[model samples]
Target chain A: MSIPLALASGTGRFYKHSAKIIRFARHGCTNRPFFHIVVMERRKAQHQPVIEQLGTYDPFPNEHEEHLVAFNFERIRYWLGNGAHLSTPVAELLGIAGLLPIHPRTYMTAWRNRRAAEEAAAKASESGADANKAPESKEGGSGTS
Target chain B: MSFGSNLRMFANKASLCCNVNKVTLELFSRCSTVAFLQYDKDPGPSFSNPDVQKLLKSMTRVQLEKVYKKRSVSDNTVEYKFMTSEQLEKQFRKAAERAEKLIQMPPIVKVKEDSQKVISRDPALTNFSNTKFVIADITYGVNSSDRKILVRQTDGTLEYAPLSIRKRINQIYFPHPGRKIRLPRMFEPEHLNRCLANFQYEFILDRACVQFDPYEKEYHEITTKVYNHINESKRFDDLRSTRHFGPMAFYFAWHQIIDDLLYDMIKQDYLKNGAELVALYYQLNGIDYDKSIHEKLETLVQPQSTIQSVLKPKASDDMHEEIKNAIGKSAEDFTADDISFEFIETFVKTKALKKVQLELALQALRETNDEKKKLYHGLKKAHGIS
Candidate 1:
């Protein structure tokens, strides 16, 4: 006779479909710690054994040297297809890596440009009325001109 | 007889100086007696008369002022005051030197031909280091519309800027130029300090204009020029690198750019009319509308007196009831606008609510408005509650 298999009975987390893509801190020989992009149960601790280690991120590598961030793109795409939500920093990293579409949060220069454009538009509309008045007054050389 | 006897006795007592030389001794005794009386603490027999004492007391203040002539006696000691002619002479000489160093500018409106002589290498201007030469004989060219503001740059070149730029800067610091920053009454230290303050403001404005002409299309070009100029010029570099002025360089740059950005908005006719757009602007900028600006905008829009007429009745009772109902209502039911938040803020502030009362009011009102959640949070933060 076969025993009935129960989901979440072993992990202590109730319900099915709990997955998170997180940056897990991993201590290295160097003074600074690096990160591991992993697929894990939502309830599991960061240092707990990950379901699958998909990538590595070395943020504090030697000066003038490019830091390494490598990942299994196929596994990432597969997990992403399975409705795995990307954390903000992880999404930013993935966006930079070209594995995912560009994240809006990471595009600060675009946001600044948009803001400057909006401001210019607002200023133009505002000054449109008074612009004629100022030039007129200046030309007239009226009181205190 | 008593007065005569007292005078004779005093004269005989002071007669020791007569032993030196008859004529010289006589003059010395007279002068010494007067000086002695001026510096003396105790009343001598000659000064014992009530009438004499009263007369001396009345005339002493006036006499003391003129008696010094060019000499200044320092009251360094508590009990005894002693100063020789040599010491007085030395003090007088130092004072003259100081007066000479402090170049007194003629009336700001008047153009003085002799100013050129006074401007060149004055001892007083030695303290200003580089700025002294520029400001010393600076000419003001007041034309029909636009006047040229000229000041000597660090590189011994006269840098020219527009009057409009100076006026804008003056408006920034001294909002009401006509009333405040009045012409100096006299060229004193305080006046000199005011001039220095103006110099700093003008210097910053001048540099900002050089760096970025807000109206011009060549923004990067102007900025690059300004950056290069500041770095290359010795005086500019000195100013930028100095501990005190280094931070102010950033401030000056930001001020110019921000002013350029805001100038169009502030000068708008629509904004000058009412508080609605001004309020929107403030909300956008995350700054509260200044009371003066608010009042000015209100007056410009309405063209009416701020005071409410006594004859006109107010709907304050209904307003109070509405506010009470708003306070009692749930967050989903009640909608709070900017005006409501402003009202609540003013209410809390005007009532001078206690810490506990303010917290209670905020807590009660927090549920009333979803839109003003950020504002309420700001209010809560201001009250020092997490």
Candidate 2:
């Protein structure tokens, strides 16, 4: 049997060696809900120690509304360039902030409903036209002008 | 009481009257009786000298009356015009009627028991009815204990008598320039006349010690307000239980209940006037507080919080279970990006983790990576690691 691609790469046959990069994660809480962006190893436990805390997102309306989200965009961009994966919620929040492309999974429920409605309308129009043609053809044999 | 001593006393009175006001001095120098007396070659006449005795003795009653009428020299330039016996009687009567109308007299105020020395008991002349003087004509002896009330004489000497002397002899107008006499604590005037004296004067509360009656309507009003407030609030019940600490101490102890805004207002008022808060607490339902009892009251009143409640040396199994559940949920709740030191500290504290267990947990989370070592050190530093 052929060796697995991951093992081949580790064996230095197919791909060059790659360094392990720590991923950024988000922790969220309510009661003056705030989000923390923390850097950590992928292999480590979610609650394990972090390499660094990038910034915070406070969605709650505090004394000022404009200060809802605060982040080191330069650091976030650096990490993103370094192939750091964003947590699902973090990706969605960033998408809403216009900082990144809209996350594919962010509005799944709304998108699904819109698609279903469009399909239903097209089917209804087709069925109505077919019913009209069938009746006209059947009646033309009986009442040809 | 001898003639020489009496002459010396009259000299001292003359010197005092001369020293009092320029207006009175000019009047006395111009007076026909004093003009006849030979004055020593001094800046002011040396009435204190023995030579003035002959002139003083030879002075007629009518001439003496003229000096007395013009002798009024208060701290202010208060002048008293000479009046005939009929005019003096009418003026004294008018003053008595005015006092009766203005002063809120207690229907029957007790003449203080100890005032017998100063308040002569000869009812006919010394009774309250006859004992009326024009306030302007009355000059006080500065020494409170002496209880000497002097009326200025026409010759610029003082007559030591109660106000009734004016009713007794119309021709004798006594005025002197001795220091203004405060109202005696023993003499309870029926009238509350603000115009009679300065309201800023503080009366001695101890009636036995002072000659003027201390049971003034204004003083009575303040003391009553404080007493009533203490009675109603019952906030000072503990302080009152001690009995040694007076109502003032009790009022001071109740400061904790006062809110910040009210306390600020009270503080401002207090700085403006020392007894503003004291008066305010009595008048309004404002809180009275003294900072001295803050720590004691805090210990006595506040309930212990959760962290303070965690006192056991040994960790309970239930506590461990709760902490493990909380940590597990917190770990699962987030995608691996966020780890909070504060949350971990709180969780460990809630478990009532032993010092050894805390050390073990901290060691488990300690970073080994070279690049992240600085961050790990920072976290530890925040947790108070040197």
Candidate 3:
């Protein structure tokens, strides 16, 4: 049987081609709502699906802890193999979560290191300037005989 | 009867009604004018006049007596009460007994062993030539029981030794020129702002990576289009061109890419889990990725996405249209590279579509130029045939 590219139910919707899913829990924490995306098998039930846990997506803070929607990645891959699809939003989320690569280049670590170095250099320069100013003011007051 | 005699009778009556104590009566007699005067003005005579009757009722007899005596009425029956000889003798005996008990009582003031008074005078003059002020030396005797610094003010009155004075005097006397007040190193606003901006870029880049799923085959086409658009704009070049490799440029470049990706996601519903996708964006951006931030972003994007989904509006809706129109009108003044379609799009979306319409109209003008060339070539070929 051909795998459906996308599937939608009360929990959320998933797009097979994109390998993403958007899961919105109807009831869990108090009155506040929650949503999540889990990669799972096409044939498996969303809540009981076999997959890897990636992360959680919570909407309301007033609710209990369980209202949060969590994702397992291994389970998601299993579902993807079984022909599960992800929705567009879920696909983007996966990309942001680092499950998928969105940008052509990754400069996260390099950028952080560069920034730290710049901050250190700036701090050093500022301290040096302050040190130089103190002596200059002292020298101005005292002229050689 | 004379007003003085009348006042005296009134005082006796007032004393009987109020149950005044002996001491209180004596005090009142000494202070009140009525005690020295007698008053026998028959209130019955005053009763005939309504005003006098009202005044009499309002002003108690004792009060009236006082008023009459104060006016110097001489006929006074009130005699000042004095202690009799026997009563004086009894009071004297009681006083003697109280004095005896006081003398007999054991000493109530106990001398503590550790009680020592310390006199701290300002060291006649501060010696600030070379010594540094030690906080420990000043604060040492402040809370101790043995050390008491009696501070005599200029007026010779002793003021409790001020603890702060000791510290101030010590500092002035022993000045530390090299004593630096070290403050915590803080991030400069500009630098921090730049860092935050760079962090935002990284975050955006991370979000783009997730959204586009650069590794995925299906996302390959969309990623290429976005990359091409970014490269064409030389947006990344601006980031690299800076002499300083501060993450700010990278951050801004990433921000642009993420915005494009988010725009795509919103339009296409590319990410199945929109909230999670946004959360990831926040995480990579170095944002707290807390529930509130997600909720806020959700509120902003969700409605926009809903509108886009139903209307299927072009990506131009995401751009501010006002800036686009401004650029279009002034296009002659700007270089081709300076014109940002993305900025124009943002302006059009935020301001109005008129500018975008104008931009399209300008493009049509370019198209017409191409048409003229085609026609010219055709006419030349026809002339050659003839």
Candidate 4:
């Protein structure tokens, strides 16, 4: 077997006091959901004691047809200035929040959804056109054409 | 003999209420909770008038004992004081002032307008995200209410965040105790009715005031439903002397359903508060009342006597004797206040929806007052109070 690129020393490879990361901690009940935006040690599992809570996010839409997210950007800037990394979901959220550049995954998902919707529309129109032609022929209006 | 008959009537009424409660409980979740007290003309300007403010304040009938009741302190800053008489008096005055601020009523007004107005649009920004982004400004020194919450939509329109989203974001940044991002399950109609049936009006209204702003539809829906239950159960006493009493009074006056509340007031010998209730109805509806009648009710309050003072000379720890003294004192106090009786009589004649019901209750009150007065006089004669 090919050797792994990195050494297998657990303590050396992953330092005890690794870089800090901004991430989500799962909250809320089944079927219902919520998240807390937290700053924590990079090697720490979720729900472990965190460095700080930067914000919260509600994935579901409210009565206003909007996803609600709250970020203490002042703290966010402080953590980032001190070199805290961001998880992919946090990065995506901040991208839409207009704090960071838009994430590439967001664009990719949007494109895929759009493509699927357009394909559905095209198929519907093609079938609709065939139905129209058949009905016209059965109605005996061929002379007018 | 009259007291025995009264107890029987009370029992029948209690059973009637239980039957109604059973029916309501058996019913499944009804359609959407309908909003109540939707004034076409904005109640805002009217509520701001000083007269209206005074009426609401007096109607609240704050009891210092309840307001300053000891509860667990949320923080570790609890203080104990040992002060001289003067210092203690000063401290109490300061506490009363703080209590005034705490019980200040939330504004009653028309529904709030939509805040999610489009600001700008960019087709290029479309397709980058599938839902609106809610961004809050966390800059220090900004008041929570005035903080900027903006939304960038998936379809490339940037707009100000709506009230719901703004409220949520604020609650997250500065979370209120006993409030959550999602409405607590207890507020659902089925559960709320159960709580209401248990006469938990004060708790529900208190939580609602914390959870919702006055002008929101949910706020109106919840409070009005609670008020309806209170009216149905005739449990106005459960809210008395608490901050909710004023708003409940206001709701009754607004909806023209003051007969039950007024009846309760008359039975409890709070005729002055009852007059104030009628006066509030007139004020809210902008009715032109005779000034003389208003002055009459004002003069009536001067002779207001407490049951405690009349019994003070012969005060005993015996519960039965205390109740007898209360009955005698209430009879004397009731007959002495003719001005309030007259004003309330005029209200019953002209305004109350169920006039005969109120009339019979009024007659009953008068008859009971007369009997008690006779009994008290007989007792005095037997003792030979020359």
Write down the TM-score for model 1.
0.19
Superposed model 4: Cα runs more than 4 Å off? A1-145, B1-37, B68-102, B292-336, B367-386
Best by the lDDT measure = 4
Candidate 1 lDDT over residue span B1-386, tens digit each: 11122122145655655456554543343323121211122222323334323222221112111222332336634445467966755655554444323211110011111111121221211111122111111112323123322332222233332333343333332244232232224223354345444444223323333333333223222232332233223133223212223222222221111121112222221112112332322332334545454444333333222111111243455533344343433222223233333533443344221334543545444444453455544554555655
* Error of model 3, residue B379, in angstroms: 99
Model 3 lDDT, residue B229, Cα:
35
- For each candidate, give the TM-score of chain B: 0.17, 0.18, 0.14, 0.74
Runs in model 3 lying further than 4 Å from the true structure: A1-10, A13-35, A38-70, A82-106, A109-113, A116-124, A131-145, B1-386
Docking class of predicted structure 4? acceptable
Interface RMSD of 2: 44.8
Error of 3 at B41 (Å): 99
TM-score: model 3 vs. ground truth: 0.15
Cα lDDT tens digits, model 1, A33-55, are 77766776776666555566666
Worst 10 residues of 1 chain B by lDDT: B105-114
Q: What TM-score does chain B of candidate 2 reach?
A: 0.18
What does DockQ give for each predicted structure? 0.00, 0.00, 0.00, 0.35
Interface RMSD, one decimal, each candidate: 28.8, 44.8, 29.7, 2.2
Candidate 2 DockQ, CA atoms = 0.00
Best candidate according to DockQ: 4
lDDT of 2 by residue, A19-71 (tens): 32333333453354455555444555544455545545544443312223334
Clashing pairs in 4: none
